[model samples]
Target chain A: MTGDQFPLWAAIAVSVLLVAGSLLMLAGCIGMVRFRSFYQRIHAPTLGTSFGTIFILAGSVVYFTVTQLRPAVHEVLIFVFVSVTTPVTLMLLARAALYRDRIERVQDVPASKDPLDNAEMQTSKKPS
Target chain B: MSRVLPYPLLTLSLLIMWLLLQQSASPGHILLGLAIALLASRAMAALQPEKPRVIRFLPIFRLAGRAVVDIMASNIAVSKLILNPNSDMTKSGFLTVPLELKHRFGLAILSCIVTATPGSAWLEYHPEESEVLIHVLDIENDQEWIDTLKYRYETLLLEIFG
Candidate 1:
């Protein structure tokens, strides 16, 4: 059977890794729905992108290493890309949200530290 | 030597990536990967970007190990926060930490490390003031975070990039 393609121990390890990774992702999704504010919600998705991606990639590495009998670590490229891009995109979205909030004068959001944005915000508020 | 191979590390990594992607170690594949890596590295040299010098190997490895452990720990911490309906988020808020690690590459690596952790996010950085704005999911003690960041990460990064 195709089930016997890999050893039982490898199968068990892969299964555990996959399940744990998916549960982390599911928790991240639940967090997205549960959190109240935009800034709070922003932290939720990182759960999936960080260790969640690493765990799943780890499972792939283990399975491929067992079957192919070679170190198959190219899956690490995905983790690298995710780790780099996730923060960049998250930072951009957060800055955009902050800018919008500052212009609208949301009470909790701190004023812009960026002088250029500070000037633009000043103009945006004064014109209103 | 430096002229032909502007970045030995970059070329070597690209070659390794090519071989891994192709999943082969044949002589022809190695030669082809070398050629591609050489061409790509030359293109990179055209940009004339200052390469980050990882001066110390030990701190680099240490930082990587620490980041992995912290990521796992924070995953559990964030998951607990998500699962507990009664968990209050009043303690969650933004933190502004002034940084002395002025090296651009050091700052970038620190940002990646901070943002990669699940319970924290890197929001913005003001280079003029040399400060970073981060959002922490659970910040019971602000000083603790500031200390952890400055001592744990920024110090290691400064060593590596220095």
Candidate 2:
């Protein structure tokens, strides 16, 4: 317990990590704006969710552990949960978009042609 | 019974989350967190989301273990490709694999599993067509990717969550 206060070195390290995380998050947001298509733009948030959150959580783990002298790694839960959930949302959104596209016969995405594929797919769709 | 706590499982998670975040077990903290959890459940009741029923528990653990290992390996692979641009990295592409599981919870789990793995990302799924569109970091063998998804993830998810 280094006096149970945030040491100057820990403060500097945490600040640097926070700034880097924020910058990565900003770059991801920029990627969302710059990308041309929805599919392309979907790649942007991975930067924030994957490496960005990892850095922030690592900083939290370090700051708390160093200051408190007892391990406080539970904040890693936030990082893990967010990383897991973001992809799920993106997947569902993409699926919804694809569903709409197929219904409208959109030309952007390639459509499958096999009848067996169609039958296989039909077995999974239950009317909601 | 009120629809608010239709699932006590979520309530347990909320309590655990509160404790973890606070990193404390003081009586005052526990009381305050319990209040918050109750209020949050009330709010959730308003949404009226369909409650997911998890059937098997053991397979869920196995799936998580697999996901952890795969994500770590994929992270190394993707990092290598990013570090060395001309290391003969295969140009990324998409594959549409037909699926058998229809339950929303199972599908959601599948999405998380696919996207969290660094070298691949879940791009889309067509519910009407029952096919999932995934973008691979390296796209050399489309069949291999499809096979991996079907066997590695879809199989276990169907068994556990479906």
- For all predicted structures, in order, the TM-scores are 0.91, 0.69
Tens digits of per-residue lDDT for model 1, A78-126: 7777888998888889888887788888869877777788788767753
Cα error, residue A124 of model 2, in Å, equals 31
Instruction: Please name the candidate that would achieve the greatest lDDT relative to the true structure.
Output: 1
Residue-wise lDDT of candidate 2 within B112-152, one digit each (tens)?
77786665678656678888778775678677778878898
Runs with alpha carbons beyond 4 Å of true place in candidate 2: A1-48, A51-74, A92-108, A111-128, B1-4, B87-90
**Winning model by DockQ:** 1
Candidate 1, B1-162: lDDT as tens digits: 889999998999999889888888999999999999999999999999987777888898899999889888889999999999999966789899999898888888888888878888888888899988898888787787788799999989888877
What's the TM-score of candidate 2 when only chain A is evaluated?
A: 0.76
Residue B22 lDDT in candidate 2: 84
Each candidate's lDDT (Cα)? 0.86, 0.72
Q: Individual DockQ of the candidates?
A: 0.68, 0.21
